[model samples]
Structure formats: structure tokens, C-alpha cells
Target: MGGYVRATPMAVQADEGVPPSTSLPDIGAASFGAGDVTVETVHLPDDRVQITNTAAYPWRVHCSLHVTAADNSEWIGTGWFIGPHTLITAGHVVCIKHSGVPGRDGWVRSIRVMPGRNGATLPYGSVTSTNFWSVKGWFESGDQNYDYGAIIIPTELGSNTGWFGFGNWSDAELLSTVGNISGYPGDKPAGTQWYAARGISSVNALKVHYDIDTAGGQSGSAVYRVLNGNRYGFAVHAYGGATTNSGTRITRQVYDNFVAWKA
Candidate 1:
């Protein structure tokens, strides 16, 4: 259900709250209307560009996540580093719900993180982590408003790969923002990254909607902006639809969670 999800930690196995994956991980988000959750909407002309150089600064900081769900199912999502060992993503990426299956709603078994990965090439190697974190709003109840999380990796890869700084923004401030999203999408060659940028389409108390082009594997990718030469993420990419794509907005509470979780 997510990454840009923070799995900067590797999971050893499915944990007590592991969730099952019945389809694409995107099933765990919210939309403006009752749209199909699994479909990845792209505007005409497909403005997303494939990121070729995996060793660059910010591009290198973004990671591709391969998750093994509690039911032994495999799913792909994206994540970006925020600290030496902390990576952020969508909550459903760590704990899933409403899969309509028995005994499949819980924490994932494992997640393999590959940073700055090009197709068939892993620039910074990889890490498999079991350590995951989410809030009660998501785990105890499948609340879309709280659908974001993190992963803690054993290694301090972010020191080398570096990371993005995220912050909370007021809706008024966001109205004038142009956001960026880049991640490995499942529709392309595996492990490949794609990039897009556009003015934010809309913003709410809990979500930020954009017209940026994205696909399934991009869930949990950072919805960020370059302010004063540094990357500041304001949302965690989550849902997609015919009208727009969205991410969990970095509200004050969500920002505090990142500060507390980042290490």
C-alpha cells in the first residue's frame, strides 16, 4: 500500500500487525470520489520522465521498495530517506486492511529497499527490513486520513545517499506551491524511476492533490518541493484517479511524527 514509505529498516518477517496484499498496494488510500483504487491515472501525453542517472543527489536519495506481504504476496512501492535510517511511505504499505480476505490484514513480512536503482542495476545495493511504524488511526482502523508510515533500516545509508527534509504547510501556502514526485513505477521496467512536477491541484487538512503523472509503484513517493535549494516534502503520495493523484499532507501532527520517527 505504500513507500516514499519509510522503511529505511529491514523487516525480518511478518509481524503482529502485518497486512495482506490482494492486488496492487494502492488499495489502501482515499480519493475525492468512489474511484477504483487500483487504477493509476495518467493525463494525456504522459509527462512523466524516466530518471536515468541513479547516483545523483536527490534522485539517489529516493528508494524503491519491494514488499512481502503477510500472506506471502509481493508488492512494489516507493520511498525516500528522511534520516540516516528513516524512510517514509504510505501506511497501507506497512499495515493493510479491507482486502476482503480473512487473516490477511496486518504488518508486512519484509521489505527490500533499493536506492537509486536503474533497471537491473542497484547503485547503492539493497536492504531487507522488518521494522515498520504507523499510527492507531491506520492500524486500529483503516482511516485514510492517517495512511502514512515509516521503515527503519539497520544501516545508516542516508548518510551516503542523503535525504529530503519535509515540513508541514498551511493550505494557503500550498496554493502557490509547485510540487515534485519521482519514484519507481511498476508500469515501467522494474527498478526504474520516473519524475514529474506540477502546481498542486488542491489541498485539504489531510491530503494534497496534484496533477503530476504517477503509476502504481509510485505510492509513498515524496510529494516535495525545492525551496531555497533544498528538498522539502509536504506529502506522502498515496492515491490516483481520473481527476487527480494525491498524498497524505504533512500536517503539524504528521510532521511531528516524522520528526519523532526519523533517526
Candidate 2:
């Protein structure tokens, strides 16, 4: 399956509702650093830069979600800080499968956000969340396009560590520019972060496809680009494959939900 693995038994339910659309100002440049890149490649490594200490990529987060069912098992995913208290992730990360229905059960019991998580060490401690948000389309029908979601913590972690701005870019721009993804992969020791870089392989209306090497725990990781010294996440990674991985593209709906959650 392209989706994440459950640590224990779980159930699915409908999401409360989609975030109501609102009028929020764009946090970063509308089209900053797009069309400035020309080179493209398939799969690339992070050039051995230590992501935990890199100043340019400060908002990467390690997420641990506790399923609130009988088994009380825990599953891991990756997320990124988009606001002082808001972190973005994949909806499936916070949702459970329906018993006999087609969609999700509801939000996970709780989530822990650890920004700048190194191996076996939490550089910024961790914040737990009871508040979670995802589009109704995802929970209602498991639409891959709307599989993105958010976490609202109680503290201002982004203030100290900074957060990634988000944007929507054209397929031409995304394919030409270099993209970066760093997250906790299940194949490694739990909570250990890994990094990868590559030009996007393809782009569809709802997903950004890339050759980045990602494992189960990396679902919900940020698929971002550093443009003009600013890192803007454009997708929430969810599906993994042997040759290609994909993320829910930050479409207008996804972008608006993110803004509403931040508000």
C-alpha cells in the first residue's frame, strides 16, 4: 500500500469539516524564485548536509501520533511548521480506517511535534496536540488530492525555530527547480531524520511526483523548495513507491485550508 502502516488496530470516521475559507494574506512571496532555475535531475542526495543543524531548513518536524483505540499503538510521520502553532501533515497520518465503510474514522487521539529532531535527541523538545484539521473530501472519500492535514500545538514552536512558508507553483517551475525533502523514515531507527533532493519527475493536477527515496514514516513530510533564501513547502508527501513517490499538491483548496488552520 502507498499509505502509512498502522502500529495497531484502528477505526475510521468522518472528519468534522473542512476549514472554512478565509481571507488571509500570503506569508511569503507569491512567486518568489520561480522560473529562476534551469537544470533538472532525477534523484539526488542532500550533499551530506546535516539537516538537524542546517539553518536554511529549520522547520522540519518529527511527528508521533497515538492511535486512541484498544491497542494504544503509536505511528510515526513527518510534518513541518507552517505557523507558530500549526504543523502540516498527511490526513491519513491523523486518521484511522473505517471498520466497514470507505473513508477515515476521525482524527488520531493526539500528536507530538518535535522540531529539529536529531537521532535519539529532540533539539526543541516536543509539543502534543489534540486539535487537528483536514479537508472533508479526504475523510469522506479518501481523495488523494485532499489527503493533506494540519496539527495545532499549544506552544509557539515556530517562533523560536522559524517555519516554512508555502506556495503554489507551475509544473514547469517545479520540474526545473531543485526540491528538498527531509523527514523521519521508518526504515531507519525511530525518530531519525533523513534528507533527499531532486528535480520533480512529474506533476499532475493533484500531486507532485518525484524520485525521492522515502519510506513509510516519511509520509506527510514536506516537499519543499528553497527559493531566494526562503523555504516554501508546496506539497505533503504521502505515497511511496520503488521508483517514484508522490505528495498531495498544495492546490488552492489545500492552501486555503492551511491558511484557515493557521488563523
Candidate 3:
């Protein structure tokens, strides 16, 4: 609870200081229900973002992204289209302090949505969120599982152009089944372009943990799966209290609120 703060929007100054780097021990992989998810391995340099995928079955979906404060700043994140122009991501990614100010000119630099792996440059379209929200409990409790946020994408994504719809929230019974997940880990310098992990839990809770690997830059990555023969995004990366090498659970929370916003 040392680094805990309310998940509320506050003005921020440009971050002129170099981003600090911390290395945590890698945990081991986890096993799950059969044939539901398949992970694709990806490697990265010692100093890049890390990520893993698990949604085994393929249902076509696109990723949502935003620009970094510094040009070429290696800030990367993961997101999926929920509606025509609306994409969902961890609010922290799209919203950052400009410098170190508490409530100043913090703004989203840029945002983009890509259709497949290896398409970071080609933003299906970019937009900003008019409003953002997070659970008060998540902020006060310091539980990574409850961390959530949404973006109110621009006109371009809403008009049958670049957006994708969301999937219904499956019960704990459904999440206990198998599923695959994907995301772009900005920390990874190479290996596979998109970090993919397989066989993750689909349960709904404040802390639905998984064995999928990820790192700091992957904070906003998506956790999804193929249910009922359709691919749908259901969650986003909040934080990791454990590691893949240590058999740690990649903590996440379902995007129920965002889905409700779309409906």
C-alpha cells in the first residue's frame, strides 16, 4: 500500500525526467483448462517492456494506442475496440502528467487503434476520451484486480470505421475455463512483436490472477478470449504482484464498466 493513490484524474506536468527502470524476478508459467488458450512466446531486450498472450481461439479484434509525451519515448500499451469509435485501455496510459505537477497540463499526447500484430504505426484512427472513471475501492484498497478505465474515442472510430464491439461478461464458471490473451509490451525490444499468452483464468473478481507474463509498459494491455466461437475482449492489465517465472498471477480486472458505457 506504499505506492497507493486514489485512481482519480489529476493534472500533471510534463515528465521531463527519464523513466526509472526496475527489474523484478521472473515467475514460472501456469497451466489451465485444455484447448481454450494457446500462448505464443516473445522475448525482449534486458531493458524493454514484457507481455504474454492467452486467448487461444482467434476472433478478429484491433488494439487501441496513444502517443508518448516524448517523441520516440517507447511508451506502449494494449487496447481493443469496444464500439465504432470507442476503444478501452488502462486510464493511466492515456492520461499522464505533463511534468511532475499534481494538477496542471496533463493530457493524452496521441491515440491509435491497430487491427492486428505489427501495425503500431498504422492507427485505424486516434482519438481522446471525454470522460474517465475508476472504482473508488480499487483506488483505496490498492487492489490491482479492480483497476479499470475507458476512452471515449473520436468520431472516426464510431462510424463503422475502426471500432470493435465488446463481449458479454462470462460468469466465474466461464472464466475458470480456458482462454487466450494478447498485448503489446513496450518494454520488450525484440522477439515477437505482440506478447501473447495462453490458458488464463476467466473469472470475475477484484483480482483475477493469471500466469501470463508482462512488465511495466504493459500496464494497459488487454486480456481476452474466444467464447462461444467468438473473440471478445474482457479485461485489461492493472499490475502484477507476482511474476511468470515464479508462477505468479498476472493480476487483472474485467472491463464491465466500460462495456456498460458502450451499451
Candidate 4:
């Protein structure tokens, strides 16, 4: 697969790049049910109370992306900080996908990232992107396997909430580990955030499947694992399947690109 990059509206001057750090707070290992366990799912009845607080997930950011080709269309998705200025998301959230054809002429006009956005609340303020990026396989062929993207912001948002670490893990680690997903769902009030935690049900080279209840705007949500007191995002949530929702798995290339972007 090939790679591609897109430009967004210019960002206001902000801090210089924050060097990547290895100092992550150890959140400890997540627990799961024993013996042939079946995961139970719960949708947040009140997004404000459940996920609005910065303490809940300081790294979670709500994205407002504008596409010009779709009649100045505005879409809501989710993303998280991987570095002081780099945010990761799904490529479809940034590019326009055409059915049965290569991607049409849709490009991101602008993008706003609100860190820890609760209903009508912006705890850390909002930042706009200076640039956008994605794999060529998705923009060129609408390949779901490469449905991931990143946004470059001006501020050091990670300094306030910290950021998620990225790694390539085996299917065994995914299936056995408890995962958490948090994002803004379109079904809920605008800017509202919700979350769900469940054990991964399946995994592949390109995706990780879970029973996590997510809605339309939740695409680009972070599918992360809490380990040794630290959280690392393993996938970028994209497709919501019938019985499961899947995210683009973090492969070696994905990890390398992310690291390079941070630098």
C-alpha cells in the first residue's frame, strides 16, 4: 500500500514540539472474567457524568472535521494525542470515501480538536490542525486495512493530559487483554463523550474486534489497553460491524509512522 499526506488550514502559533517521553503513569493491569467469559457491554446513559471529566480520560479529544466536497459537510469523530502535537484518527474521517470506487475529490478543509470535551464543556480548549496525513491505500483504494490518519496541531496538548503510547502486539495479547474505548457519538448530544470497556473478541493483522457499543461519530476512537499503569492505543477505531466494531490494528509500519510524526 502507498501513503499520502493532506494539508489543513494553518494553525495559530503555539509551543514548539514536545519531545516524546517514556514516562507514563503506570495504571496497572486490567482485569477480565475467568473461564469462557462473555463480555458484557454498557452504553453510557449520561455522557456528561460518565465521561465528561478530564480525570476520566484527559487524552481523549473530540474532532470536528470539515470536508468541502460534501457541501461543506461537518463530521464528528474521535482522536487522541500521541505526542505534544500529533493526534491519530481514522483516515475515513479525514478523506471522502466513494462506494465501489477509489476515493473521490474530498479533502479536509479544517479540523478542530477539543481535548476532554464534555457536553458543552471544553476543559482544555480547542486546537486546529496544521496538517493531516493518511496511508495511500485508503485514499487511493478505500482500503479498510489502512483506514487510519493523523492530525498535526500547534499546541502541546499532551503536556496537559499526557498521551497514549503505541505498540504492535500479538493477537493473543489483544484477545486476552481488557480494552477501553472512549469517543463522541453522534447519537448523543453534540460534543458529548461516552466510553465502554470490554475484552477483545477477535484480532487480525489489520483490525481488532470488540463488542464495545459505539455509534457513528465514534469512528477514530481509541482502542487502548491499560498495562503496568500505562495506557497504549493498539488500534484506531473505524468500522462498526454488525456484532462487533473494529479498529485498524497498530502494525510495525503504523507505529513507525506515528513515531516519525512525533519527531
Candidate 5:
């Protein structure tokens, strides 16, 4: 089970609802095919998205990255800026190379992240990086349980752009009750699959979980719980469990480390 396995692409079923919010592009109609599996956008009149999807108020850093396959083709996942130059992602979305392999180092390249992206094809604000950090101990040894990593953006994301802060690990219940997952699902194509899912705090609270279905491409999405009906990212996409495939969960340890990283 420890051996490298083919990655599964993250996918959300097509939503046939009224459509998405006016703020976001009509991703459901513009991209995904028709099916019974339609994802309701953040703007649903009845659905309350204090933690996960809709914009309760303003916004902050927008995280972005390129997912390259062995064939050289690539897809992208979007994350928000958690710290200055530090963006979090699901470990599986971005590949990890263990030590002792010649020319096989674990890091991210050709990476670009933009803060505060709008409906435009490109980012309204963008930042790129040359260095990244994973859980130091887990990277050295393959540990799926701690599947999280950080990208060191050389540029400053700057204040007033909605840089994020971490929640105290002591309150896991706050995370469990309300939360949401946002990311670019790879199956839909660039600038086409951005979406959000309503989430509930996972049983452990260390990780965030929800009924929002996802596929392989959506691995490293930011999982946040509601604080006063506002979304604050607590975990980066690590992986989903074997049993409950409804959505992916992000662990607390991975999130805590990234929040504490400096320089």
C-alpha cells in the first residue's frame, strides 16, 4: 500500500440548479456535462455558506498551482495565501519525491499563485515561487497520513489581500460544525472548473469533511470551518478516506505547521 499508485482525478458531478452566484463565472454550465450530480453554487438562496463556499463578506489570497503528470501535460489547483509566500495544497495533487533517489527531489516547479482572482482568464493579482516545504518529517519518509505541503512564494502576497490565519487546535468542534472546500477541479479544464462545496467539520475536527463530492483533481483544496459565519482555512487538501468517498478531509497537523512557517 506504500508503493506509488496512479493518482485518481478529482471530479464533481454536474449541477443542474439555477446556476452559480453572479460573482463567479457559470462554471457548472460553461464546463461540466449534464447529469443528476449537479453541484449547487455558493449563491443558493437557502444554502448558508458561512464556512465553506459563498462569499459571506470580502476575500483574501487566491492559491494556484500546476499539476504535471509523467507525460508532461499538467492541470492546476487553486489555493489561498495562508502566509506570506506560503500556499498550502493536497500532497497527492502535487507529487512528492523521497530522498535517496538521484535527480528525484521532492519540490514544486513551474509554479504560479495569484491572490484575489476574478472572472478574468488570468489572475487579478499573481505571485510565483521557486521553493516549497512539505511536512519535514513526512516528506523524508512516505507518510500518507500527513499528506500536506507548502509552496514558498518568493514574492510577498501583501496585506489587505486577505492573508489567512490558523485556528487553535484546541477547538475542533468549531471546525466540524461548519466549513467549506474550494478548488479547481482538473476534469473541467483551466478557468472552467472553479467551485465550492458545503462542508461539516469532520468527526475529529482535526480534518474538515463534507457531503460535497470530489474527484482526483481536487486533492489539495483549502478546508475551512466557519468562525462567526466566516471561512478560515484550517487544513490543506491531504486525501480522502477509503470508506467515506463523499469528500476529502484535511488534517490539523498539516495546517498547523504551515501556519507556523516563517521566512
Candidate 6:
């Protein structure tokens, strides 16, 4: 018999550097899942160290964020892949809050995700997406405690690059663990990635506070801990406070949501 080939459905990906639409036809605030500044909440003597070699594992997993809000206002934040095509960030990153104008207060217009991006250099390239998701607590009320969300890209960009495993940890476990945060900070050069690690300062039902240095654009960065050589996320970085920055803890409910969204 002559050689034959069976066609298999393959994931179609845009060419490297194919940027997302600069302006999505106004979707209006109602038709969205929605909704920063480029201010990191870093403490005095910023301890964040830049990751110049963004092509490596873990570091490469970090992404620089550029969001176009529903009101067409632009901001910067950070996000990380947790699944083949899913990236998690602050709920505010997906849905703008207050914005002073209620009419422009829902989901963001679009986002351009650059994984493992180095300053002026895209080691892993970039993709623009309009798909986003957030919980009712945030989507409806814009609660800071509920400020965490996911961005789904059409391509499986994480397959080759890999992702982080997120889980719910007890207060005891979290308090005893040192959390890690790495992302693009506004205080640093545009597109460059930075990192910090510190013992978790506090943990509550809704938030995990840490002394890890982070600036404005670092929101949505994973607050993860390494266990036996594996990295597992315990929270979703969200707010910066005067004493300590914090994240939305990955409670059972949030973990369930993440699993559901990834599926």
C-alpha cells in the first residue's frame, strides 16, 4: 500500500509578534466578562531584581501585561500561565473598578500578553486577546477581596513554555511558607521582568499578605511557593498596602473556579 497521511486537527496560532487589535469595535460595558497603573507597592529599598534572561523556565513563565480598558484607558500589570491557554491575573486586571464613570466600569476592552518578555525583546513573543473572566464578587461589586481573574488565549502558548500548579493551602501552611513573586513592574524598564521572595507575613480567609517587593505593574503575579522542587500557587497578587502587599488567597472556591476556567 502507498504511504498515506491522516489529517489531524492542529491548533492554529498567529504568527510570532502578531499583535492584538489595537481597538476592538466598542463591545460596550454590558457585553463583557470584565475588567492599573504601572505603581508597584514595593517597600523602601526595593528588593526586586530584574530577570534579564526571560527565556528560562519559571522566569519565562512570567508575563508582561498591557490592558486596554472598556473605557479605552490603558494600564500595565502582570500575569502568569496556569494552563495551556489560560493566564491568571488580578480581577481588576480583567475588570476595571470605579473609573469614576459607571458607564465605563465593567470588563476591559482587550489585552496584549507577552510571555517571557525582555526589555524591547520578546523572547517568547506575544499575543493579544479579548477573552477574560472574573467572579461575581468582582464583576458585580468590584470587591478588592474578590480581585482575581483569568485571561484565556486562543493558542496553547503554555504547552511548550509550561505553567504553574495552583492549590489551596491552609493558614498554617501558608504562614510557614515563603512566597515568590515575579512580574513586570512599572518602576523598571518597560517589558522587563522582576522577581522577589519573602516569608508570607500574614494570611486570612481572603488574602495573603507578604513583604515581597512589587510595584504597580506586578499585580496578577502568582504568589507561589516551592515545595520539593515544584512550584504551587497559593494566591493571586492583587493589592499593595502601606505595610505589606497582598493577594487574593486561593481558597477552595477560587481553586474550583480556576479549574473550571482552565477547562
Best by lDDT: 1
Over 1-263, each residue of candidate 6 has an lDDT whose tens digit, in order, gives: 11111112234334445433232222112222233321247788888888887898988788887777666766777889999899998887877766666566767777778999887677778877777888878877766778788888878888867899999989999999999999887667777788999999999899998889987677789999999998989998877768888999999889988888788
Those runs of model 6 whose alpha carbons end farther than 4 Å from true positions after fitting are 1-39
Q: After superposition, how far is residue 251 of candidate 5 from its true place, in Å?
A: 6.7
Residue 59, candidate 6: Cα error in Å is 0.9
Backbone clash tally for model 2?
Answer: 6
Instruction: Give the C-alpha lDDT of model 3.
Output: 0.41
Evaluate model 3: give its TM-score.
0.56
Tell me the tens digit of each residue's lDDT in model 5 across 1-263: 11222222233223222211223222121112232223222222323222222122233454435433233334455556665556666553345444233443344333455444333333335544545555534455545455565655555664435565555444456434545555554444343335454545354533444545444444566666657755566655544333332222344454446655534
TM accuracy, model 6:
0.85
Q: lDDT by residue for model 2 over 2-116, one digit each (tens)? A: 2222222123233222211221111001111122311112233523233556233453443433223222444566788888888888876666444232332455666556676
- What number of clashing residue pairs does each candidate have, in the order they appear? 33, 6, 38, 5, 15, 10
Q: What's the true lDDT of residue 150 in model 2?
A: 80
Evaluate model 5: give its lDDT: 0.44
Q: After superposition, how far is residue 98 of candidate 5 from its true place, in Å?
A: 8.2
List the candidate 2 regions with Cα displacement exceeding 4 Å.
1-71, 98-104
Give me the runs in candidate 4 sitting further than 4 Å from their true place.
Answer: 2-4, 8-49, 55-70, 99-104
What ranges in model 5 sit over 4 Å off? 1-60, 67-73, 93-105, 116-120, 158-160, 169-176, 199-201, 205-208, 241-256
- Name the TM-score of candidate 5: 0.62
How much lDDT does each candidate structure score? 0.79, 0.62, 0.41, 0.65, 0.44, 0.77
RMSD (Cα, Å) for all candidates, in order, is: 5.5, 11.9, 10.1, 10.1, 10.3, 9.1
What alpha-carbon RMSD in Å does predicted model 5 have with respect to the real structure?
10.3
Q: Please, what are the lDDT tens digits per residue for candidate 1 over residues 206-242?
A: 9898899988778789999999999999999987878
TM-score for each prediction? 0.87, 0.75, 0.56, 0.79, 0.62, 0.85
